[model samples]
Target: GTKTISYGCVGGDFNEVLHAWEKEGGVPRSQRCLDNFKEAFEYCELGDLGFAGDAFMWRNNSHTAEKYIKERLDHVVATQGWCARFPAYRVVNGDPRHSDHRPIIIDTAGAAAVRRN
Candidate 1:
C-alpha cells in the first residue's frame, strides 16, 4: 500500500500581514514582506482557513483614531489533506477582552453547529 502524508493545520499570530488590506493606520507593509509571506505559503502548500466576524485580529489599543492601528496578524492555515477531512471547518475571530489580539476559534463540526443560537 502507498504511504499517505498527513499535514495538520497551523494557527497562531504570525505577526506579519499577507496583504495591504489586512493592515490599517500603519506605515503600510512593504511589498517585499507580502511577497515573502506568499512565497512561504505557496512553498509549504498551506491555504488560509479564512475567518468570519471581525476582519482585524489585532489592535494597538491607542485612544486617538490616528494613533490607533489594527491588522489581521493572526491566521489559520491547513494543507489540502487536512481540509479534506473537515469540509465544513470554520474559523472565527473572537473578542480580544483584555488583550490586544483577538482569539482564533475553529470548529470542525461545521459552521451550523458552532453558530447555534
Candidate 2:
C-alpha cells in the first residue's frame, strides 16, 4: 500500500469538478465523477487542502452573465505526506491569461506563525 512511491503535485487544467453547486447547497454532486475523484485521492492518499479565494476560478468568459458562469476547476492538491511537511501552502491569484480561468500560484511555504503574549 504505502510501498507505492509517488511524488509531485499533479495539477493543471482539470477542466471539470466544479464546487459551485456544492457551495450553494442546492443539490448533491454527480456520483460518477465524484466517486472517481475520491477513489483516486484515496488511492494516492492525498489531502484536500480546501479551495481558497473566489468560489469560481473559471468562467465561460461571455458577455452575458449566464454565459459567464463560473466554476472551480483549477486547484492545488497535495499528497497526505506532502501537506504534513508544508502546511503553509496557499493559492495566489494572478492575472487572467486571456482565458476564462485565472492563473493560480501554489505557495508551499507555510504561513508565518503568530505569537501572542
Candidate 3:
C-alpha cells in the first residue's frame, strides 16, 4: 500500500487559549479535544499558521453584552514537510455572513525564497 501523508485541522473552543500564556510559566488547563489535537499535531509534525488579529473567531449571535462570548476555535494545521515548502501561510478575517463565525482564507502559496550571497 502506498503511504499517503495525512494532515488536518481539528478542535473546538480550545477554551484553554494560546500555547504560550506569556513569557513566564503560565500553562492553561488542557481539554480532551485540545489534547487530541496536540497529539495529532505532533504525530504529523504539524505547525500552526496562527490566527489573525482577533483572538476569538467564534461568538454568540446574541446582542447581549456578555452572551456566550467568543473563543479561538478556528485554526490551520499542516504537516512539517508542507510548512517547509510553504512557510508564508496566513488566515484572513472578513465580515461574518449568516453565521457567528467569520470567514477565513488560508494562502497556501508563500513568497518565493530569495537567494543571497
Candidate 4:
C-alpha cells in the first residue's frame, strides 16, 4: 500500500484569473490566459478557499474611469485534505489603504474578523 500526501496549500499573488468575471474595467483577458490558469490549478488539485468582501482585490488606481481596472489577482487555495482540518476556514480581502493590491487574510478559526472595502 502507498500513502498519499494529505496536506497542501498555496497562497499568493498569482497575477492571473481563472475566469472572465475576475476582472473589470480592462480589456478582456485572453482565453488562453484563463485556460492556462485553470489547467494548472486543477492539475495541482487545489481548491479555491473563496473570499469575502469586495470582489476585486487589486486596482489600477487610474484617475480616469476608462483607464481604471480592478481584478482578483491574489488567492488562497488548499488541498481537500488540508481543508478538512480547518473546515471553518475563511478568506478575507483586507483594505489596501496605500497599496494597489489588497491584503489576503486566511482565518482557519471561521469567519475572519477583518474590515473590508
Residue 74, candidate 3: alpha-carbon lDDT: 63
**Of 3 and 4, which scores higher on TM-score?**
4
Give the C-alpha miss distance for residue 26 in model 2, angstroms: 14
Q: Encode model 3's per-residue lDDT on 13-114: one tens digit a residue.
A: 343434433112223346665667667666666666675666566776656654545665666666766666656655555567798776676665433322
The alpha-carbon deviation from the true structure for residue 8 of candidate 4, after best TM-score superposition, in angstroms, is 1.4
**Candidate 2 local Cα displacement, residue 90, angstroms:** 1.9
Q: Tens-digit lDDT track for model 1 on 37-58?
A: 9888877888998998898999
Which has the better lDDT: candidate 1, or candidate 4?
A: 1
Task: For model 4, give the 10-residue run with minimal summed lDDT.
Answer: 108-117
Model 3 RMSD, rounded to 1 decimal: 6.5
lDDT of 4 by residue, 1-117 (tens): 453657787888999887899999879999999998988777778878899988798889699999999999998988898898877788889888889888888888764333331
Candidate scoring better on lDDT of 1 and 2: 1
Query: Runs in model 4 with CA error above 4 Å?
Result: 1-5, 111-117
TM-score of each: 0.89, 0.70, 0.60, 0.87
| CA RMSD, predictions in order | 3.5, 4.2, 6.5, 4.4
**Candidate 2: segments with Cα more than 4 A from true spot:** 1-3, 18-29, 95-97, 113-117
Instruction: Estimate the TM-score for candidate 4.
Output: 0.87
How would the candidate models be sorted by TM-score, starting from the highest?
A: 1, 4, 2, 3
Residue pairs that clash (backbone atoms under 3 angstroms), model 3 = none
